[model samples]
Target: MCREPYPGRVTAPVFVLTPETVEPAGAAATAVAGDRLVLTGPEAHHAVAVRRLHPGERVDLVDGAGLRLVCEVTETAADGGRRERLAVRVVERVEEPQAGLQLVLVQALAKGGRDEQAVETATEVGADLVVPWMADRCVSVWRGVKAARGRQRWGAAAREAAKQARRARIPEVAELLTTAELAGWVRRVNDAGGLVLVLHEEATVPIGGVALPDTASSEAIDHPADEPRGGGKGPQDPVTIAVVVGPEGGISAAEVGALEQAGARTVRLGPHVLRTASAGPVALAVLAQRVGLWG
Candidate 1:
């Protein structure tokens, strides 16, 4: 729903204003036409110094939680490096509902930043969330403080990719998990009536041939509106589709067996095998097409 709908158009040079940035509870929710909003800190610096945005320019601001503000800049000032201010008058405010299908990427650790690249492209291809998995055959491992740093890097990548894609909502990066823990995750998703696909080269079924969840029918089931998504038992939540991508050495037989037992369907992309970095994105592209997300 939108106030003063623009009808089939949005401005460029988008900036994110997450809920954490807003002060005084409910301020953002109450914003209306002609209301002035200020932008400071790193985002303002990018708007003022890097982008050289001038007064009278149009830019879009998103809360990454489905709220988009079509605004016109009225002021821009830079004090120093990473210190600046940008102000805009809100023209229209829109509340976008979540998509019916949620795409999640479960990527295994790999050497040489391949895993990071995988997530970046997947985010660009419309993945809703990313999960880091320490597969049994992984060459790279995250331990101690390194694990936190790795997760932060992946989160940063997803944010940048979202910006490049002009996506209103940025994909979330989940906590790292081991193979055993991933099996439990698969079970939870399956128990909640979601689909989990494990990409394997030897699989008989291709990703295109695999049956996707019927979002139309899923939406018909009665459940509480406030119920959470993914692992929830509620049928009202959007159907989650998680794609599991293994490391360079591929998933071990034991790991595959465990995931299969947990209710994951193993599928292949095509005749040729893709690298760990490219497999997830390729599969996601196919799924996005099959599920009508691309349309």
Candidate 2:
């Protein structure tokens, strides 16, 4: 006979949701409804076998889309010879959107496995996008199957971390890029409404001093005496921001020059030297704070 709720007995509910199931529904719009959600794939397995959740039992269901659903298990199917099924009925749902500052971390690939840590931290800190930059100083080489596997692993980490943080949007992990490729990406993102900021200790200006180009500035209307004049629409829309970080050995002078030539403004995080893996997320958190993302 079991004594009344044995001392130190495990009571906190174990999750049935895993990275595989969570990733698909994480960003999908149709995966969840108000106070109701459906679980499939590995999530279904965890619910049935690992947790042994039964009908009428309450549980929390979090979709990586920033919706947290408090639900009750309404049906359960568990048999030794057959697959299991678990159904949940949502009791409540909460939705929280990402902050106004759409920060993207263009992180240089680092030696060892630090890139993964960077990805995980960026996801937790609410980075809207993570681009793996293969700078000249980057020591870890990624190609073909290794690159694919690494990306999958990073995606899984991001999904799990997003769920843990209860974020509404899953940050994207872009395919790896070389220095030249990264510059082109910067140009594309700039055209898409982002201001490019490259983090370099050599920069004299702090990020706080860098503001979006004001539409009303006289420069918007005045034609430079040295340039050919052409009619144009009003000042370009507010540029979105992309923050770039360097590798373990830090960015080279030539690479920095390239980024600057590509229209990226260099800014410093502070006086202390932060590892390549730490700088991107630190900058992101600062940007998030500046834009009132932190509650």
lDDT of each: 0.82, 0.64
Superposed by TM-score, candidate 1 places the C-alpha of residue 116 at a distance from the truth, in angstroms, of 1.1
Across residues 142-229, which tens digit of lDDT does each residue of candidate 1 receive? 9999999999999989988887776777788888999889999899989878899999999999888988877654322333324454
Give the per-residue lDDT digits (tens) of candidate 2, residues 171-281: 667788889988877666555555778998889988777775322221112222222111112243223467898888889999888888877889988888788778888
Per-residue lDDT for 104 in model 2?
76
- Which residue segments of model 2 deviate by more than 4 Å? 1-38, 46-70, 75-85, 92-101, 213-239
In model 1, the runs with Cα more than 4 Å from the true position are 1-11, 19-26, 217-229
Extract clashing residue pairs from model 2: 35-90, 65-168, 66-167, 66-168, 193-240, 194-240, 195-240
- How much does candidate 1 score in TM-score? 0.90
